[model samples]
Target chain A: MFRLLIEKELREIIGSTKFAVSFGVCSILILLAFYLGAANYLASVAQYNAARAENLRQLEGLTDWLAVRDYRIFLPPRPLTTLVSGIANDVGRTIEINGRGDLVAHDSRYGDEPIYAIFRFLDLDFVFQIVLSLFAIVFAYDSINGEKERGTLRLTFANAVPKAHYILAKLIGSYAALAVPLLIPLALGSLLLVVMGIPLSSNEWMRLGVIIATGIAYVGVFLTLSILLSSLTQRSSTSFLMLLVIWVMSVIIVPRGAVLLAGRAVSVPTIEENNAKKGKLNAQLWREDREAMTKFQPSSSSDPQRMASEFQKLMQEMADKRDARMKQLSDRLNEERTNAQQVQRGLAFGIARVSPAATFALATTALAGTSLDLEYLFRDAALAYQQAYAGFMFKKTGVNLSRGMIIMRTESGDPEKPKSINANELPVFTYSERGVSEVMQAVLPDIGLLLLYNVLFFAGAFVAFLRYDLR
Target chain B: MESGQPVFEAIGLTKKYEDETLALDHVSFSVRAGEIFAMLGGNGAGKTTTINLFLNFIEPTEGEARINGIASHKDPLTAKRNVAFVSENVMLYPNFTALQNLDYFSRLGGKTQYSKENYHAVLRRVGLQEEAHTKRLRGFSKGMRQKCGIAIAILKDAPAILLDEPTSGLDPQAGFEFIELLRSLRDDGKSILMSTHDIFRAKEVADVVGIMNRGKLIMQKHAAELAGHDLEELYMKYIAGHIRDAA
Candidate 1:
């Protein structure tokens, strides 16, 4: 009996022209997003290789390892980032690994290419949040009420069918009709990535699988919500209007409003204030160091080698002191700001998670390793790489670069015959992605919330339909 | 089951809408097996309300609408299994073929063993053209749709059928064919409860004709008793509130 009812539902939706048009539009958009994502990743790969080559070319004649300054490391592109984007485009991609002071990342994709940010990437998350959700609403907003309007409700209920079985069939059959077909485009897009020769690791495949699963769950949220609203209203038009208002509030208004509210509610120190304070402290330290340097007298001036060693030692001590003081101040300020921002971000996302769309976006982005956490993850990886770099430079120059020293070796040799530095000897930065288990653990809350929503709305629809006036 | 027992009954059935308007005021009637009970009234005369109660689409304010000795409200699913219903509009899923609609409603009525041939035979039995059976119902005419509804009831083979103005929009010739079909169904021992405003058709087809005023059954007569009487005049007199004066 349930099978027959579900079959009827499938036949009803599949035969409608609405399904044809919506499925077509969704397919085209999904394929386009995948194609563009591959193209964007390829472009980034080219740019990364070019930047590395340029950094190496600039060091072709420098024999001294300490002479090479501004050796930059770029954040490598991940294929999944192109699909779920998150804050990947918003955050900086280039971090200059210096032997001295605190570092900052620069060269954001959106800064370089403002047009893409204006419309944003047509990623899977956006499609699921905006397009697929609309399709769900369009298909299901009148699911129950439309039957009433057409006068089929009374005719159907006249049978021996239990309202529970009928409502469950409606949800299952509609979901199968709407969501199963969507997988076709998702599969095609995934194949397009392979066809474009974008290598996906086994881990990446798992992440992609979860992303698609979450997309389906997200679409389910809207489908059940529509059914709930449909049973609540007498007219399809009224249900649709109410659903449209809900969609707007959940998808567009709530997440951003929470962020704005959090921003006003929580106080974090501005970057400019931190920078200005650091600048003043730096000037004071430099003035003191300069005064001390003026009184520097090599006690062993009669011995040329001793005099050179003594002078290097004194300079290193002063530089180390200044570095320590800067570190102390910067660490304090950063810790303060980080604590405040953490509170602000926690409040914002907590509120935003009230909406399923926000939950989906946040979870998928985290799974894709491209949420706002992308910025900190990249910085942490670069900072770890700097440790190996500092060790390598110390071996090459018999002096730790972390001393923030300027070593001047005046060599009287032919400029054309100067030996080149080995760029390969520089420590390579390899970023480690969050383990699948770790990511799954992190987003379990959101996924659970999504399922809870489905159950709640399904129950709501079921209860509402049981009492619904078939007439 | 006793041979003389009523297959469908309304015992003191009453319904009041949320607006406090009484839609069915302790209306009582019964259709034994093989009886054609035609209920006649003007608009909002508790005719369709009676059928709705029997189908359990809405709850009755008082008493019971029983099918095959089971109270519809007490256990609607089990009770409805013993009955079939065709609403006024005969609206099925538009995307479904006539045959598909028959197959669905037949299955819903718990007749799962009906085959394609059985559905086609039933459709043909209701005078639907063989060519129209497999075509979608979206483009079907009102009469064609009505034939499909009757076909569904025929396939259900239930002991009782509740039709709410089943022939409301059917043409004269279609109405005549539907009446003949109803007569044949009655001969097959199916109790039929039909609500309509057509007085002459009620007089012609029904074994027992009931006239309702507002929410009360004001008059009832067996076809044998009503023979040679002008049913249209009687219906008009009752609708005009003259029955009380005459009484």
Candidate 2:
């Protein structure tokens, strides 16, 4: 009996042209998005590489062949970036530094180019949140009420099968149909990535699997909600329209509204304010250090050349102190900026909870390591790298390059070595992979919310259907 | 038809709509096995209400109906299995062809393996042409659809058949043919309960005629017992007297 019912359902759904048309539309949309994503990633990669090559050329002109130890150029994205595309391009620097400092400025040349930041490739996170959930709503909104409108429900329920079994069968069947198209395309995309020689480790595979599973679960939650609404309503058109409204609210309207609300709530400090404090601290430190250097200058002029050399060394030391003080001020400003941003993002995330779309986006971005959180981490790593490079150069070189380099070590081997630094001593930019437990912890609340929606919808649908009159 | 038993019994069945209109008030009737019973009533005479009580389409406000000695409200499927229903204009899947419709309904009643040959034989028994078998019902005439419906009832082979105004929209020729079909089925020992306003047809075919007025069974008599009186006159007299007394 159940087999016959399933066959009947399959037949009816296939006979309708709407199902075929919808499936076709979804497939085309996904294919288009895939091509677009690949194109955008390639374009960005090309631009970043070209710019980095140019920056490296400029750096070579600044440092002599043997004195290249004063600088280390951080080049563009590696090939693996195209697959996950992570946060590498967003916070990366083309210009590198080997100088004397406790902290170093970001790629000075690129910081002025704000246009690059806006046009960066949006990652896989964008695809699942916006496209997959809409498809889910379309698949499930007509599951029940459409049958009722066609007057098939009476015959379907006239059989000895329970209504609960019937609803479950529909959910299972539609979910399978919806998930199949997405899975095949996603698998093909992954294959293309591999064929293009983007490296993926076993750990990356595990992470990707979880990300896909979470995506399916998120879609399942919405599908169940649509089904529940369809069951509760009398007309299929009304149910479908209601579902469309929900999709718009969750996917488009609510997230932006939440961000706006968060912005207004805590008042994110402007970059101008942040930079003003850094400038003020640098000036104060410079003035105090210069006064100290004047006091330390020798009063006697008997040994005039020695006094001049000693005064030069004293000025160099004082310059180093001023640089250290400026670095401290900059670090504090960055820390404050981070704290303010964190508070705003937290408020935004809280407000965005009204929409499942926001939850799915947050979870997927975190899993892919393409989130703003990941950007912050990368920024800290880059800053630390810059500081370490500067420390190595200052300690190893005899010349203070603060007043601009005066041709130190004219003849040397391995010109690219960090000035005044051991080549093998500094720490590499080794980012630790996020553990599964940590990933789960980060997304557990989202998973809980989705499950909550799933349960609530099924429960409401069950109760509503139990009372429905088949005739 | 089984002997020594009432196949249908209505014990003061009553139905009141939310508007407080008494659709069926203290209506009661019974049919013994092998009896061809005809319910004759004017429009709004509670004929459909009585039939719905038997079919359990809606719950009764008071009392109950039984089919094959089983309470219809207590066990709907059990009662419905013992009976087959044919409305004035039966609703079927318009998308399906006539043969497919028969096959679907047969399968719904837990019957399978109703082959093409069997379906053709049944259609021929009901006098529907074989050429009309595969055509969709979109363009079917009322009489043709009626024949197809009779084919379905014959295919079902239920012990008791309940029909509502089976000849309402039929031409006189089709109506005569329908009566003939009923007679043949009755000869085969099938018990039938039909509701109609056709007095002459009832006189010609029915073994027992029951007239209802204002939700009440006003008159019931064996056709043989009223052999001398005109059924038309008897029907008019019953309706006129009942309405006059109520006024």
Candidate 3:
């Protein structure tokens, strides 16, 4: 009997024109997302390689390590990032490793191409978050009430069917009818990923698989909610309107509203304020250092080279002291701001996760390595690389490279020209993505929330239908 | 299923709505095997309410509506297993064919053993054309949809059938064919309870006739007892408060 009810529901849905149109639209959007993601990834790789090569080219003729300025390291693009695209494009991609002060990433994709920011790329996350959710509503908003309106509800209940079996069958059948067919497009999209030569490692493939699963779970939330509303209302139109409003609230309004609310609730110090404080301290330190430099006297009976070496040593010591004080103040301010931002992020995401759509986005972005953590991860990696680069510079030139040291040379005194340093000899900076286990740990809570939404809405629908008036 | 065995029984069934409308009040009637009982009444006369109680679509405030000796409200699944229902407007799945609708409903009715040939035979029995059997029901006319609904009931093969104003929207020829179909089902020993406002059709086909007014079953008699007496006039007398509690 349960099987028969499900079969009827599947036939009813598949045989309708609404299913055909929704399936077609979903397929096109899915394929388009995959294609565009692949193309976008290829473009980013090319640009990244060019930028790295250009940075190296600029250092080709440098005769000393101290003169090598404007050296930059770039954040490598991941294949999944192009598809999910959470904060991947929003955060800066290039970091100039100066071995001094703080490492600041610059040249973000969105900043470079503001037009893309205005209208973002068509990624899989967008399709699943917005389009598939709407399609879920379109498929199931009339699941129960429409049958009543068509007079089939009375005819169905006139039999020996249990309400539990009937409602369960409706949910399972509608989900199967709508979600199963979607796999065709998804499989084809994955095939497109392969055909386009986007190199996804095994861990990335697993993440992508989880992302698709989460997307389906998210779609289930809307589908079950639609059925719940249908069972609660008498008219199909009323159910549809109610579902539409909910979709708007969950998908459009809730996440943004939560962020705005969090913004108003929590106060994080802005970057400009931190920078200004650092600047004020730097100015006072520089004035005192200049006075100290002016008061320096040369050693008696000194060789010209020894006098120059003595002055260079004093300058390096003062600069080192100044750099240390600035570092201490900067670290303090950054820590305070980071803590506040963490609090604000926790609050925003906690409230936003009330909606399944936000939960889905959070989970997929975490899996794709494109969440807000991407910025922190990049900066941390760059800071670690800065340490290595500074050590290398110290070895090449017997001075602290991060102390703002100035090198002076008299051209006429040299009998032989100095050899240009090899730019390739510099230590390479590599950024590694978070391991699969770590990402899954971060993503599990959101995935659990999505599943909870599905179960709760399905339960609501089941309970509502059990008490529904067939007449 | 012996002859004269009560397949459908309503013993002192009472229904008082939350609004206190008194939809059915102590309505008691029985439909025996191989019998056709017609409840003749106007709108809001508690004719449909009794059928609803028999189907357990609504619970009776007091008393029982029994199908094959099973109280419908107490054990609806078991009671409903022995009964088939045809609504006044037999709306079916518009996206399904006439045969498809029949197949689905029959399966739901626990008659999964029927084959395609059985479905075709039942559709033909209900007077649906062979060509329309495979066509989607969306474009079906009122008569065609009615034929499909009756086919579903026939395919269920339950001993008892309930019809709520089944012939209210049928044309003259369709109504006559429906009457013929009801008689054939009766000959097959299926107890049928139909509610309608059609006095002449009730006179022609019903073995027993009942008239209800304002939640009360005012008049009931065998067709033989109603012979040579105007059923319309009798119905009018019961509805106008002239005849009181002649059940």
Candidate 2 is graded, for docking, as: incorrect
Q: lDDT by residue for model 2 over B147-210, one digit each (tens)?
A: 8777777776777778888899899998999999999888876778899988889889988899
The DockQ scores of all candidates, in the order shown, are: 0.70, 0.20, 0.88
Which segments of candidate 3 are over 4 A away from where they belong?
A: A288-317, A410-414, B242-247
- TM-scores of chain A across the candidates, in order, are 0.93, 0.78, 0.95
Tens digit per residue, CA lDDT, model 1, B1-247: 5887999999999999899999999988899999999999888889988988998888999999999999999999889888988888887888889988888888888788988999988888889988999999999999999999889888889999988898888899999999999999999999999998888788889999999978899888999998878989878877676456636
Best by TM-score: 3
Candidate 2 residue lDDT tens string, A297-397: 57667998788778877777776677676767777777787788889999999999878878877776666665565555554565666666555556655
Q: Which of the CAPRI classes, incorrect, acceptable, medium or high, describes model 3?
A: high
Stretches > 4 Å off in candidate 1: A286-321, A408-418, B17-20, B242-247
lDDT (Cα, tens digit) per residue for candidate 1, span A1-471: 899888888889988989999999999999998999999899989998898899889888888787888888889999999988999999888888875556788899999999988899888888899999999999999999999988788878888888889999999999999988999999999999999999899999999999999889999999999999999999999999999999999999999999999999999999899999999999999999889888889887789999878877887888789889898999999999999999999999999999999999999999999988888888888888788888888998876777766756676766675477888888888888789999999999999899899999999999999898887
What CA root-mean-square deviation does each model show from the true structure?
3.1, 6.2, 2.4
Interface RMSD of each: 1.1, 3.9, 0.6
Tell me how far the alpha carbon of residue B202 in candidate 3 is from the true structure, in angstroms, after superposition: 2.2
* TM-scores, one per candidate: 0.93, 0.74, 0.95
